[model samples]
Target: VGTLTFKDAPSMVTEFAAVMKKMASYKHSIGTGDTNATDETRVVDGKIYLIINPVNYYDIVARLTIQNANGVFVTNMPFISPDHIIQSVDVPVNKLIVFIENGYDATQSQPEKISEYKETFAMKRATLYAIDMLGNGKPVDNYAAQVYDIAIPTSGGSGE
Candidate 1:
C-alpha cells in the first residue's frame, strides 16, 4: 500500500484518480500460496478490487462498495474535510464495507446491498435488500436488522 500526499488540488485529483482506477480493476497473476492474486486458484480471497476517490476532496460522506482480494473500497463516510482522518477499517471476507458520512444524522442514512456478497457469480442477478449491511462492519448481524447489500459481484468476474 502507498500514500500520495499533495498540497495542490490538481495534483491531488490526478494522483487520487490514478490510484482509484488501479484498485477497481482486475488482472491475472500467478503465485503458489495465499499470496497469489492473479488466478482463480483461491476461494479464500474474493478476486476483485474496488477503488474510490473523494471527488475534489470538497466533501466526502457515505461510502460503499464491494470487497475482494487486495482490499476494500470506500462505502460511506462523512464529507472528507482536510481535518477528517481517512483510515482503512478491516473487513473480513464474504462481506462488504459501508460507512455513512454523518454518523450523527439518523435521517441522512446511506444504502447497503442487502444481498451483500450472497451472490459472487456474474450470472446471479441482483435484488435490492437482497443482503444486509452491518454498521459496525462486522461479518455477522447487528441487533434485529442484520444489515447487508442490495447487490454483489458474481463469480464470473473472477474469470472463474
Candidate 2:
C-alpha cells in the first residue's frame, strides 16, 4: 500500500500523472520482454479486484459509476454478501463514484440516497484498492481504502 497522501486535489493529480507515466514506461518495457523491468504494476488474469465492504444497512446497496476513456459506465456494486464484496474491474479507470441507495422497488425507480463519495483521481490499471467503509474517520482506523501493487509470479502463472 502507498503511504503517500495529498493535501489537495491538484497535488494529487500531479502525483498520479507522474506515477502513471512511470507505470506506462514499465509496461512498455515489459511488453518488449525486458526482464529487468520494474515490477511496479502487475496484471493478474487481466483484471484487478476492488474489495468493497459487505456490511451495509438492510435494503441499502452500493452503486458505482466509473468513467474511463471509453465513456461512463454504471453498475450496482454487489456489497450484499461476502462472495459478492470483491468486484473485478477492468483496467485504466479514470474516475470512480460510489454511493449508497435504498428504497428502489423497480428497475427504473429512483432510490433514496444515503451518502456518496467521488474520487476523481486516476486509479492505476492493475492495482488493488481495499475499501473499508466502516473504518473511516475513526481514531483507531482512519483510512477509507488502501492501494496495493500486485506481485507478478516468476513461474509465468497468474498469482491468484
Best by TM-score: 1
| Alpha-carbon local distance difference test for all models | 0.33, 0.31
TM-score, every prediction? 0.23, 0.21
TM-score of 2: 0.21
RMSD of 1: 21.6
| Tens-place lDDT digits, model 1, residues 55-108 | 312222222223556796434321223333332334333222222222122331
Number of the top-ranking candidate, with lDDT as the measure: 1
Residue-wise C-alpha lDDT for candidate 2, range 10-45, written one tens digit per residue: 554564444333322222233445677543443222
Pick out the ten consecutive residues of candidate 2 with the lowest summed lDDT: 95-104
Which residues of candidate 2, in runs, are more than 4 Å off?
27-160
How many clashes would you count in candidate 2? 0
* Residue 11 lDDT (model 1): 53
